[model samples]
Target chain A: MKFAIQINEGPYQHQASDSAYQFTRAALAKGHEIFRVFLYHDGVNNATRLAVPPQDDRNITQQWTKLQKEHELDLVVCIAAAQRRGLLDEDEAKRQGKDANNIAEGFRISGLGQLIEAGIEADRLVVFGD
Target chain B: MAKKFLFVNRKAPYGTIYALESLEVVLISAAFEQVVSLVFMDDGVYELTKGQKTDAIGMKNFSPTYSALGDYEIKNIYIEKESLDARGLTLDDLQHLVWEDEDDDWAEKDSIHLVSSKELATIMADQEVIITF
Candidate 1:
């Protein structure tokens, strides 16, 4: 099955993000095709690599980056939500005249159209949030 | 190919960004030319309420955008009757949303449908893609 995942909450604050990660991981392990992973609202916070957890705790952001790298996943962070949360890439940072870019590697900033396209193209569009 | 896409909204406006973000996705969905529908339930019923003034809250009044959904071909807007009754609201509490039927010489018609939970479930089950916010 082809799946498109939507995560709507930030890491640590809500378990939805972690569940979304686990679901995506399991889907890929089953040889299912992943259409895309869209991060919206506070979910865009997952794109920021600036968060640091305790040494023994799970690094949620890095986990996504690692999974994205291994699967070559098209992890998308909604640009509007990301900008509101200050999660930016180098281009967006430069365009908005910001000092830093904290978006994690392998996650790209895009518009809501990507989410719509995922709905249109994927067999299932699974959402995890409050 | 076009698919039946349904957006389920269950939150009140301003308390969280989900309501606004759902509308944002709805607008974008129009470009995909799919059969899209919206359902307002629970506190989400408050989202379609009329006379929403955000001046004190300092938030952009996006409530008017619901009025524009007709133009985007978002014709079916299901409001849960149970939710309205639970909140002590009637159809009059929400915005008078309408759409123009080109086949009928551009005559305006109501777009909002007050449906029972069973009807809402049928609508939901008919959709190929369901995204809740």
Candidate 2:
């Protein structure tokens, strides 16, 4: 099966971000294909390149980057949500006349249409959030 | 018929408009003759509790609205077991017969299903479309 995951909750408030990762790993282990991972609402925080977790904790950003690199997953961060939360990529920061980029490399800022597209293409669309 | 996964009630059914708006969408989807199923998870599960006293909140206790689902022939209602357990509720405490256990024998219920998180994932995987609140 091909899966498209929708992660809506933020990193701090809920366990959704971690759940998405866990589900992704499980789906991959099952030998299922992943179409994309769409990050909306607080899930956009997972795409931040500047996230610094405590020394004793796991780094979600780094984990996501590694997973994407290994599997070539499409990590899509909603552009509308990212802009509202001050998570900007290089192109968006330049377009909005910002000083620097904040989004990680493996992630791309995109529109909700990509979400629609994911739904159309993938056999399964799993949503993780509150 | 196309199986449309209509996610009704996203909010707590009081504070935010997401829940009500989602209901409208679900009704619309059902009107199209699509096979719709509803899952109440997270704060959205509050919408299912019976005998809600919304008077203090200056709002109508919309929990009764669930009873009207039968009128629309929208019988595929599913509630997360963990959600009800967290709130200290049972299936009898709800306005409608929601599933208490994911693997609970629901063959007796009329078009109603009780699903665990894992079952919900499988159902979601098989659906043609999903619209979250």
Candidate 3:
């Protein structure tokens, strides 16, 4: 099976991010193809490298960064949502006259069109949101 | 091939950002020329309600944007009847949304469909892709 994933909550404030991560892992474990993971709403916060947690706790952004590295997953953060939430990439930050960019490794900022294309191409579009 | 795409809006207008963000996605997807349908369930039905004045709340009044959806060439709008009844709302409470048919000399037609849960289930089951917000 081929799947496109969209997560719509912030990483720590909600469990949707964790659930989406687990579901992506489960799908990959079953040898299913993940077409893309498009983050929107507060979900773009998951791509912020500025998130720091206690040593014993899980680092949500790192987990996704590692998974993306291993699977070469196309992790996309919606540019409109990201900009609104201040999760900017280097280019986006520069374009917006910001001083810093917090986009984590393995994640890219893009337009909603990528999400629409994912829905068109993937066999199933799974939304992990509130 | 064009796929059957359904977007499910399950939240209210101002209390949460889901409704507006979901509308953004739907509007952007219109450029793709896909077969799209929208279902308003739960508090989402409030998004199409008439007489939304955001002046007191200091928020943008985006309720009128629902009427412009027909102009985007994307016109399927489904309102869950049970949800409406649960909220003490009826079809009359919503804005009169319509679309034009180029096939019939651009005749105006009703775009809003008041459907029961079972009817929505059938519409949902037939979709190739369903995105819930």
Candidate 4:
């Protein structure tokens, strides 16, 4: 089965991101194909490269990036939500006249269309949020 | 073949980004040609109330966006009747949302449907995909 995951909350403040990560990992372990991982609302905060956790704590952003690198997963951060929360890629930052870009590696900023497409293409669309 | 897609909105607008962000997804889902249905329950019913002015709150008033769902060919919008009564609201307090059915000679139809929580639950259970925000 193919799964598309939607994360709606940021890290630390909520357990949504952690649950989504664990679910994705378990799905992969069971040999299921992850169609896409869409970040929306506060969930866009998970794609910021500027997130730095303490030495003992798990780096939520890094975990997502590593998963993407290993599985070649399609991780999409919603552009509208990202802009509202100030999570921008290099191209978007330059275009929006911002000084810096903080999008994490292996995540691309796209539109909500990607989310709708995921719902249509994936066998299941699992949403994690408050 | 259109897949059954249910958008479950359980959060209130303005206080959180879920309502607006979910609306964006609902609008875009039309392009996929899916059988989309929206249900507003709990505090989510507040999203459809009329005369929402965010000017005093300093938030962008996205309430008007709900009216545009009809333009996206999205007509199956269900509001939980129990939620409305609990909040002391009625259909008259909500905006007049309607859709024009092109296939039916452009007949104007009410987009909002009032259903019991049990009925909404049944509707949700029948969906192939259920997305909540």
Candidate 5:
């Protein structure tokens, strides 16, 4: 199966990020193909490279980074959501007159149109929300 | 072939417009002779609870709209079993009829299959379109 998952909420405030992670891993383990992982709304936080959780727990950012690296997943964070939340890539940071970018590696800031295209193209688009 | 479409509702009906908008979409899709299915998950399952008092919000209660699904031939309504159990709700308490995840009643209702999240994933993969609210 080919799937697209949408994450639409923040990490700390909701379990959406965790659910997305679990679902993605499970789908891949089942030999399913993940067409794309689109992050929108507050979900863009998952793409923030600056996020650091407590040492006692699993770091979702690092986990996602590993997933992206190992599986070559398309970690797409919505550009509008990223800008609003102050998460910028190096290019976007420079364009916005920022000193540095905080967006993590393996994640690219894109437009909502990509989400629409994935929704139209993918066999299934599962949404994870709070 | 009529397209099989599923609307996954994840929010409450009142506080946000997502629930209401989802209902509208289901109705519109049904009108087009599409096989529309509604799966209420998480907080969205609360939308079907009976005795809703929208009067506090100065709005008419819209739960009744769900009861009219039969008139529109949109009878495939499903609520996640885990969601209901987590919220301490039962099928009898909802405004409209809903089958549980393990319920065999769906088979009696024809091709409408009440399913678990695992089955939902497979069903979703089979569908032509899926929208999340």
Candidate 6:
């Protein structure tokens, strides 16, 4: 089975991102294919490279980046939501005339269309949020 | 077969980014040509209420975007009647949303359906995919 995941909350503030991560990992362990993971709303913050956790704590952004690298996952951040919350990639930051870009590795900025496509293409669409 | 996609909105507008972000997904889902329906329940009913002014709050008022859902071929928009009553609102308080019915002599038809919570639950059960925000 192919699964598509939607994350709607940011890290630390909500358990949504963690639950989504666990679910994805478990699905992959069971040999299920992950179609895509589309971030929206506060979830876009999960893709920011600027997030830094304490030495003892687990870094959420790094977890996602690692998962993407190992699984070759399609991790997408909604462009509109990212713009509203200031999570920009290099191209978007330059286009918007910003000084810096913070999008983490393995995640690309895209539109909500990717989300809808995931719903249509994946066998199951799982959403985690507030 | 096109899957029945039901977007469940339980949050209020503006207080959080959920409402606005959910609308973006709904609009984009139209392009997939899926059987999409939106249910406004709980605080989500406030999303459809009229006369919203966000300039005072310094946030862009995106309420007008609800009216454009019809243009995207999304016609099954349901509002929980209990939610509206609990919030002291009625159909008159919401923006008038309509779509052109090609099967009905091309007449304009109201798109918003006032349904009870029970009815909304049944509608939810029939959906192949249910995304809540």
For each candidate, give its TM-score against the true structure: 0.98, 0.59, 0.98, 0.96, 0.56, 0.95
Give the candidates in order of lDDT, highest first. Answer: 3, 1, 6, 4, 5, 2
Regions more than 4 Å wrong, model 5: B1-127
lDDT per residue for candidate 1 within A28-89, as digits (tens), equals: 99999899999998999988888988989999889999999999999999998898889999
Give a tens-digit lDDT track for model 5, residues A1-130: 8999998777867899999999999999999999999887678888887877889988888889999998999999878668867999999999999998998889998876676566666788888875
lDDT of 6 by residue, B1-133 (tens): 7989999999999898789878988988888889999999999999988999998899999999999998888899999999999989999999999988889997989999999989988999899888999
Q: Which lDDT tens digits does candidate 4 get at residues B9-93?
A: 9889988888888888898889888888899999999898899988888989999988888988888999999999998999898
The best candidate by DockQ is 3
DockQ for every prediction shown: 0.91, 0.08, 0.92, 0.85, 0.10, 0.82
- Runs with alpha carbons beyond 4 Å of true place in candidate 6: none
Lowest summed lDDT across 10 adjacent residues in model 3 chain B is found at B66-75
B-chain TM-score, candidate 6: 0.97
Interface RMSD values for the candidates, listed in order? 0.7, 5.3, 0.6, 0.9, 6.1, 0.9
Clash-forming residue pairs, model 5: none
- Better candidate number, 2 or 5, judged by DockQ: 5
Tens digit per residue, CA lDDT, model 5, B1-133 = 5667777888887887567755755665555666777788899889888888887788667788777666566667767778878888887677645333335553424223346777667767877777788
The lDDT per prediction is: 0.93, 0.76, 0.93, 0.92, 0.78, 0.93
Please give, for residues A18-127, the per-residue lDDT of candidate 4 as tens digits: 99999999999999999999999899999988977998999999999999999999999999999988999999989999999999999999999998888889999999
The order of the candidates by TM-score, greatest first, is 1, 3, 4, 6, 2, 5
**What is residue A49's positional error in candidate 5, in angstroms?**
1.2
Runs in model 4 deviating more than 4 A are none
Cα miss at B80, model 5 (Å)? 20
lDDT of 3 at B114: 96
